[model samples]
Every structure is written in C-alpha cells, then in structure tokens.
Target: MPKAFPDRASTGWHSHRRAQLLFSLTGAMAVDTTDRRWLIPPRRALWVPPGLPHSVTMRGRVDMRTLYVEPGSGVDLPSSCVALEITPLAQELIIRATEAPLLYEEHSIDGLVMRLLLAEVARLPTLPLWLPLPRRAALAQLCEALLTAPDIGAAAAPLAQSLGISERSFARWFISETGLTFGQWKQRACVLAALDRLSAGAAVARVALDLGYDSPSAFTAMFRKTLGISPRELGRAKPRTPIVAHG
Candidate 1:
C-alpha cells in the first residue's frame, strides 16, 4: 500500500497479523518498539515481524509504501524488527508490487515480480540504524534520555555517576547487557540521531555541532565508518519515486 503522511504524523502503537516491510520513497520515519528504536531514512525499510507492537512517526512528509506478507507465507524473515538497506532493484520491485493487483495470477508477470521482490527482501542487508535499550530500568531510562537528546561527547564517568555505580563496574555491566562497550553504544546513538537530522535536510556541519561533535569532518568520519556513506552523499541521494508498473 502507498500512503502519504504529513510531517510529524504518527501511526500510534499498532501491530499487524502479517509481517510488514515499511519503506518511504521520500522523507524519513522513526519506528519504536518496546526495546528498540529504528530510524528509517530514504532508501531504507523496516521489517516488522508479525504481532510486534510498534509505532511509526514521520520525520517529514513521507511517501510511505508498505508490503504485507501473510504469517505462513513460508518466506524466511527476521524474527525481530530491523532496518534494511533497499537496493535500487528492490526499490523498483517494491513500487511495482504495491501497484500490482492484489490477487494476481500465480504464473503471471505480477506473480514473478512478487516472487523477485520477496527474494530481494529476504536478502537485503540490515542497517545499523537502531538502538537497543538495556533491560535494567535505571539503565534503560538513561539510554532513553540520551536518545531523546543525543550528545556525542557524553561520557561514561558522568553517566555511571548518575547511575550511582563506579565507572569500571558500569563499563563491565554495560557490555554484558547491551553487547556493546559504552563508547560503542554512544556512537551508535549519535549515528542514529545524525541520520534523523540529516534526512530532515539539516546541514551536516550544523547537525555535527548540534550533536556535540568538534567538527563536521570528525562527525563525517564516524558516520562513514558506521554507515559506509558520507552525510553529504546521503543527502544528495534523495529518493525518487519509481515509475508505476503496468500490467
């Protein structure tokens, strides 16, 4: 299905009986579940497994496209929510599938498109555009605060002090709980925040400074290392609507 959401519009907590691949041809969205939050920028999609309660908030005017797969479709999909990098081929196929008849013949062209699209979805590379929340209540609250107002310069000493734990103990517990070192987790949080801002047309330097980076170059280096693409390149690669497929 193809739908347009005005800037800041939200689809309050909901779940589907079938799995869904949520993509946007333009703008960006944030998908929040119980334990993680995913930022879906242009050219990326979020795979929501069946029965996973989630909410999507538009970062801008989003031209959203969604594909629903029945629960027993026999396709191998992730059990949890993930952000997938959509290749050009998959982008075109998704657009076509959204336009195809709902009940196209099994051996027809629409069927072939659907089959190819499913294959692409099953193999699409997952992006590191999500932040996993810690299970502990106090730690989770701290993480949530950082996500709400991410600061690249946030330090473990201050965070640990706020949690009433020694820095060394906090470091050990953090890695054991989240599977990432404190610095690593902080960087991921900053990257997700930068993506959200960049997709909304924020200038790279402005976003860098706003996120507490010393310089745009410093921020770009981290962004490229984590996401494999520079901020400017991503901004320039704005998504375009694919031509509708004719039966």
Candidate 2:
C-alpha cells in the first residue's frame, strides 16, 4: 500500500502474518522491532519477517510504499528484521509494485513486475542501520541505563559486578547477544540516541556535547562514517518521492 504520513506519525506496535517490505519513497522512517531499531532513510528499505512485532515512525512528511508478501512466496528474505539497501532497479520496481492493485491478476504484467521486485529485494545488500539490544534482562537493563545517562562513564567491570557475573561472561554475552562489544555497543547506542534527537530537530553541537563527543566535528565525522551524510543535511534534504508508473 502507498500512504503519506505526517512527520513523526507512527503505526504504534503491530504485527501481521505476511512478511512486509516497507520502502520509504520520501523522507525517513524509524522501524522498531523487538530487539533492534533501524533508522531507514530513503536510500534503504526495511524487511519485516512474518508475525514479528514492529512499529514505524516517520521522521518527516513521509511517502511510504509498503508491500506485503504472502507467507510463502518463494522469497528468501531474512527471517529477522533488516535494512536493505535499495538498488536503482529495485527502486523502480518497488514503485511499480506499490501502485499495482493488491489483488492484481497473477498472470498479467503486474504479476511479473511484483515477482521481479521480490527477486531484486531478496538479493539486495543490507545496510548497517539496525541497533540490537541484549536479550538478557539484566544486560538489557544496563544498556538502557547507559543509553539514558550516557555521561555515566561506567565501565564494564562495575556493570558486570552489579549483575553478579564475571567481566569475561558479561563481555561474551554482550558480544553474542548484540553483535557488539561493550564499548562498541555503547558508542552505537550513543550515536543512535543522538540520531533520534537530531531527527527531531536538535542542533548538532548540542547533541555532540550531550552524547560526550569532545566536539561537534568529532560527532559529524562519526555521523558521516555511519550515515554517509552530515547530520545537518538530514533536515534540509527533501524526501525522494518515487515516480510510480501509472496504469
């Protein structure tokens, strides 16, 4: 389905039986899954596996194109939520797919178009937009605390002790559950939290100091490395609305 959402509008938390490919045709979106959250820009699409709880929040006035794939349509997308990089070919096909009728004839040109879109989507590369959390309650709680009071400067030793585990075990759990070491996950958490503020129109310098970055330039460098664009441009860039081919 194709829908336009006002800035910051959200779908709240919901799930469905069919897998979904949510492509942002304009503006940006934040897709929150059970343990991970993804900041999906126009350059990316988010794949949600069947029955996975998710919520979508628009970053600006957003034109969202969503395709619900049948539970078993032969597409081998990731069972977990992922941010897929949108190739130019896949981008065009997505627009076509979004505009096509939901129950269009399977043997017609629309059918072929949708099949090709799925094929392209399946093979598309992924973006590193997902921020995963620990599944363990204690570690998850620590991560939440760290994200909230980022200035705590608490080391893993203290956190591990508080959790009644050895530092070695805590490190292993952190890496295994979140796919990031304690320090790496902390940095990622700070960056992602900064992104939430930045998208909501916070100034760059203020976010930088708040997140413990020594200077705005340091934060900008990290943002550039992660997002491939300066955070300042996030507000100024117009959402890219795909030109759907009309029947």
Best by TM-score: 1
**Pairs clashing within candidate 2:** none
Best by lDDT: 1
lDDT of each residue in 1-247, candidate 1, tens digit only: 8999999999999999999999998889988998788888987899999999999999989999999988766667777788898888898898889998788897999988988888888898998998877899899889989988999889899889998999999999888778889899989999988988999899999999999999999999999999989999886654555546566
CA deviation > 4 Å runs, candidate 1: 238-247
Candidate 1 CA-lDDT value: 0.89
Candidate 2 lDDT over residue span 1-247, tens digit each: 8899999899999998989899876677888888897778764689998899999999887888898888778777687788887877887888888888878898999999998888888898887777787888888888778866664145899889999999999999999999898887776777666766776668999998888888999989988887677888755644445645555
| Cα lDDT over the full model 2 | 0.81
- Give the whole-model CA lDDT for all candidates, comma-separated: 0.89, 0.81
Error of 2 at 154 (Å): 5.9
TM-score of 1: 0.91
